[model samples]
Target: MFPKHVRTHHRLHHGHKPEELDFLIRRESVSGGATSSQMQREFGRLNEEEKENLLKGVGLRPGIPSGAGLLLKANLALSWNKLRHLRRWLRNWNVSLDSESKDREKAKGMTSPLVAEQLPFTFTVKGPDGKLATEVRLASCVCLEDISSTVLQRLDLLEREGKLTWHGVIPSDEIWLKIGGDKGGGSTKAVFELCNVAHPNSIENTIVWNIFQAPDRRHNIETAYKINLSQINALCGTMWK
Candidate 1:
């Protein structure tokens, strides 16, 4: 149970009903098992909104999120917020890259026309433990299948170099690109644009790429497809840590 001053603080700041606030304080007290001094220290760390939520509670009456759960949720929210910011940054980067590419193309004129439609992008492959396995530059203007193949080839090389190791065979079909930030679907044109934006120096230079290995299940592979660049950036922002 909370002290009189704590109750007054809740009433003053949160305006929660007395009975409701009492219930939440009791629940949190049981879940946290903190001394009064510890509680004060923890409470002091919370911002105004968090302090209000702590008193008012979350979810149902008895099912309020525990301190640990609240901490996890806060971390997740922070990560998502960072991801959103990264998405904005990537969008700006893409626009800048496009402008530069156009200027270079105009400068070259008809004398040095690009021979092949090469889409160079940076590839970042993560192992099963959510660690970076390898990162490389690849140039290809092809379908998703071809892109997956190229990524797999790089993974194979890394595995041989002892940079990456797998539990069992990571089938080529199980290897896929999580383009942009989406997990379900992506297209060649989107990949081309993303690569072009991320690799403005040369269409043959590397652009941002994310390689993920799906579960061994057939359904997972079937559902996997290319995703948008913003989505990829968002995913990277979240998963990189």
Candidate 2:
């Protein structure tokens, strides 16, 4: 008799719990970012014969998300640790892009705005004077890449023009990307590593969710939206590699 249990699905799936059907559900969800009605069709695709094998616990898991994808989902989830990351993910969008045509001959061109609206993000960088600079507002759709380029360019131009020795998030020889929020001289926001804070629409989304909320007596944590920048003055001179 053929064995009831065979490690047949391992080639297709990994790290999945056999008993839990959430993997199946998530797999359907990821299939072209399936809609609710369409994904319901996956409920009982496993036939009786297939379920018999599954019952033998000889299969791997499915719907495993990448590390970055997991983090994005976790942070955006509604929880007490509600991090205000500002970006809309296409994964959660209602419609499927796959529904459109890839054939240039058959498909008509279309465009959609990255975000439905814009938000204002205010921040400050520290100058060599050991004091904080004035408020700099990124008053529209902005991302981490924009921040990196804009901050670097603005600082370089200022220094080149003898504006003032700015010693902020710009990494020096020793320190790299030292920036945080609540920069009225001291940082009260969490010290975000370069990798941690690197994201899209983070600047604007955070501001919209965290700062643009209805004014309330208990609505605090505006500092969570804060991005203060500072660095050791002498650890590494502006001599970058």
The TM-scores, one per candidate, come to: 0.17, 0.19
lDDT of each: 0.39, 0.35
Residue-level lDDT tens digits of model 2 in 1-241: 2122322335445677885445644554455434355545653687876654564465433322333333443356433222222222332322122211222222222111122223334455687887987543433321232233333443454457664322554434332444443322221222222311323224322321112221111112332232312222332355432
| C-alpha RMSD of each candidate structure in angstroms | 21.2, 20.4
Task: Compute the lDDT for candidate 1.
Answer: 0.39
- The sequence of per-residue lDDT tens digits that candidate 1 reaches over residues 104-161 is 3544541211223334344458979999864434344322334333444544554566
Measured by lDDT, the strongest candidate is 1
Error of 2 at 75 (Å): 7.3
Which segments of model 2 are wrong by more than 4 Å? 1-62, 73-180, 183-187, 190-231
Best by TM-score: 2
Cα deviation at 144, candidate 2, in Å, is 19
